[model samples]
Target: MLTINVAFLLAVIVLVRLRRRTEARSRSDERFTVVIVLALGVLIAPTPVGEGIFDLLGQLASGITGASR
Candidate 1:
């Protein structure tokens, strides 16, 4: 049995979208890319990579907040 990792697929989609020329993408194309990137984030949020990202973001946020005080 082969399991398809959705996050992997989404990452590929993101990469492909990023490789395209920015000037060639229309508004709808930009919206679709946003949707795909959001979906990719959702798909990745349950895994170890997600945890690392969360941790990194937390640290960055804390640093920013701390610096402001």
Candidate 2:
């Protein structure tokens, strides 16, 4: 749920920034960004590579929590 919410926030930020700028772009720009953002989501997900990162962070978090911190 939080992940979806964060994605929404990021999408809004992307749209808002693009909206604030004054420039003309081809349709491809929009399409490309859509694809790129989707790829970013996959990359951020807990795939093989991402899982290691998540595990490391989880360890850090457990340490910080220190038995119900």
Candidate 3:
């Protein structure tokens, strides 16, 4: 049996989209790419990696707020 990590697949898609030439993409293409990336994020958000990301973002946000005060 072969198992695949969906997050990894999504990351690949996101990277490919990012690497594409900006001028070649239309508005709808941009929107579709955003949707795909958002879907990837939702898929990732329930895993351990997602938890770490949330924690890191939280700390970063607090640090920014603390620095600005």
Which one wins on TM-score? 3
Q: Which structure among the candidates has the greatest lDDT?
A: 1
Worst 10 residues of 3 by lDDT: 4-13
Q: Please report, as a residue range, the 10-residue window in candidate 1 with the lowest summed lDDT.
A: 4-13
**Candidate 2 lowest-lDDT run of ten:** 1-10
Superposed model 3: Cα runs more than 4 Å off: none
Residue range 1-69, candidate 1, lDDT tens digits:
999788898899899999999999999999999999999999889899999999999999999999999
The sequence of per-residue lDDT tens digits that candidate 2 reaches over residues 8-35 is: 5666656764774446656787777677
TM-score of each: 0.85, 0.36, 0.91
| Candidate 2 vs 3: which has more lDDT | 3
- Ordering by lDDT: 1, 3, 2
Enumerate clash totals for all models, in the order shown. Answer: 0, 0, 0
Model 3: per-residue Cα lDDT over 1-69, one tens digit each? 999887798899899998999999999999999998999989989999999999999999999999999
Clashing pairs in 1: none
Flag the better candidate by TM-score, 1 or 3: 3
Q: Clashing residue pairs, candidate 2?
A: none
Name the regions of candidate 1 deviating beyond 4 angstroms. Answer: 1-3
Q: What are the Cα lDDT values of the candidates?
A: 0.95, 0.68, 0.93
